[model samples]
Target: MSLFNVFDISGTAMSAQSVRLNTTASNLSNANSVSSSIDQTYRARHPVFAAEMNRATANMDDKASVGVKVLGVVESDKPLTVEYNPNHPMADKDGYIYKPNVNVMEEMANMISASRSYQTNIQIADSAKKMLSRTLRLGQ
Candidate 1:
């Protein structure tokens, strides 16, 4: 791969991480939302990613290489937690309030991971730029 390809790879990674962070933020924001019924409860969402292989080289012999691609966002399949609270305003007839399956600690951990990935990509791109500049200076 060409040295310039580093930028493309890192750029895609950064973009993917941005989407991840956005979804994590959304999940965290709705963590405390209450609903009277399961159907109305907010579900935690996560971004699905898939590696985008190079279409130009259809030959598998080329040693398949890929970049990041966001397949789509999917809701968590885990069951929602229901709490019996008769005093709750959103409680249903059964006196149970539905809460989102989102876990605050998990979301916080994901946020930190995404942030670190973004920073790493930025540093990679910055280093590539510096190296290219230094190479050009050698000709002067």
Candidate 2:
């Protein structure tokens, strides 16, 4: 693969990680939100990613240079947590409050994993740039 391919791959990864971080933050922000009904509660969201293969180049079989693309964002289908809070203003007729299904622990873990992956991609891009620079000096 060409040295420039590294930048494309890493850039895609960084973009994907940014989406992940944003979703994680949104999930965490809504973790404590309460609603009177399940439909009104906020559900955790996550972005789906897919590998974008080069469809334009039929003869070029360079698979290593392909990058990732965000397929879409999906909300969690998990059931909302219901709690009995008669004193809460948003409590339903049965004195139940609906809370988001978001798991704080899982979201935190995802944030850490996404961050590490982003850092790794950055390091790979940096290393590739250093190698390319050294290669340019080889004839000197």
On lDDT, the leading prediction is 2
Q: For every model shown, what is its TM-score relative to the native structure? A: 0.91, 0.93
Q: What is the C-alpha RMSD of each candidate to the true structure, in Å?
A: 2.2, 1.7
Cα lDDT listed for each candidate: 0.91, 0.92
Which 10 consecutive residues of model 2 have the lowest summed lDDT? 54-63
Alpha-carbon lDDT of model 2: 0.92
Model 1 over residues 1-140: C-alpha lDDT tens digits?
55587787889899999999999999999999999999999999999988776542684665444668898999999999999999999999989999999999999999999999999999998999899889989999
Q: Clash totals for all models, in order?
A: 0, 0
Residues 20-72 of candidate 2 have per-residue lDDT tens digits of: 99999999999999999988999999999987765425426654677789999
How many pairs of residues in model 1 come into backbone collision?
0
lDDT of 1: 0.91
**Model 2 residue-pair collision total:** 0
